[model samples]
Target: MHAWIIWLPVCEAGRTFGMDSLGGWMFWIVCVCFSVWENAALKVNMRESSLEVVRGDSVILPCSFYTSSRLSTLNIIWTLARSSSPETPIQVIVYDYGQVIEDPSLIGRVAFTGLPLSADIILNYTRLSDAGTYRCMVNNLPEKADPGIGELELSVLEPPSLPDCKWDGDINLGGSVRLSCSVAEGVPTPDIRWEKVNPEEIPLPINMEGDFSGSVQIVNVSSQTSGLYRCSATNIL
Candidate 1:
């Protein structure tokens, strides 16, 4: 934020005043223009405010800042509100006067990946415990401006676990069959699919009923329907 100011001074009279004339009063018009930097503080920006990465993978939290001061005077700090303590943020890393100080817990798992005026960082070997909120702070000395801050929410994904498949029905020719599948645990609910996989690999008998959530039903089974079936569950990590 900025403001402009104009100063205008008018003389008291056209004639110059002397020591005895009008009590030595003299004035002249003076014009001046200046700017006031009231809100010229640093600004921080994030390319992506929220991000997700698979467990064990590396991810980058992007951050940048704008400031009128020199980059050499910049100081950066990154903090995390880990899952264990959502309300309390711990300092993860700091960049001060060309030196870096990292937290012991993140000494080997995190790295600064940005240049001057940027706070981008990468987290390596991510884990479910790493999912949390992160903050990036930057300040330039001698500016007396507010520090630039950016925030990001991180999510470490867990892949779908193995699925359990079962069937309930008699082997009789006219018996109805219900094939069901389920995944006991996964970060995101896995998608379930059933497919016929035997006897020349033909498609599942038509008119099958059931939703993708995990089950399929076949009515009036026949010898032609006899085959191997498979159930699969999957989700992106």
Candidate 2:
């Protein structure tokens, strides 16, 4: 619905009167005369409130609207605010009547999945940078909607790369050594796990300390600490 507000010089001065009987009466009259409410008939809703997809994948953002307005007057706009700069919105696409206009930066990679009848759109070759909030706004002019905007949160997942394991310092008995494990890249950063790989699958030595940051230290290493070690990295899909 729409609420139109108008300001008059007298209204501003009335506030200084401290809401006395006369001031209160004038305020009520001004509100009743200057503020008007018009009921809206349009309705917009999002089909999927949120979505998650892997990097390099294609994803569809769904939006729908119902209005008694004619098709010739319908206008739909799609905008996005990337997670990096959430306050700055970039127009992704616009459907004015029957013509479709796409943002230059996303041209050839984005297209309307369902046009004219729906506001759904598809994004191809999704990247980690594409993770953000998307908005769909529909306007039918004279018939304002209570909520003409729908929002969807998009997340792009990246799996951890193959981990590289190495050691610093000597592995000899009574010597100190630092075992390091790392992945080239990963979204949400992968967790690193280090384990001693012995024939009997024995427990790790008490002198060994491991860290999720991909490092393990063994102080005063002994026979118990001398064995093959494995490092594994994992992250959410």
Which candidate wins on lDDT? 2
Candidate 1 per-residue lDDT over residues 1-237, each given as its tens digit? 233333334447685544444322321211111123444678788789899898889999898888887778788899999866898888988998888889898889988886675788889998877888999988887665454788899988887778777789976899898887777666655666778887665444322233324777877899877888887767775
| CA error at residue 55 for candidate 1, angstroms | 2.6
lDDT of 1: 0.75
lDDT score for residue 67 of model 1: 86
Per-model lDDT: 0.75, 0.81
TM-score quality measure for candidate 2: 0.75
Q: In candidate 2, what are the lDDT values of residues 1-237, reduced to their tens digit?
A: 334444433446456434453666666766665444244378899989999989999999999998866778889999999998999989999999688999999999889887778889999999888889999999887788869999999999899888887789877778999887777777776777777877455434322233334677888999877778887778886
lDDT of 1 at 24: 25
Clashing pairs in 2: none
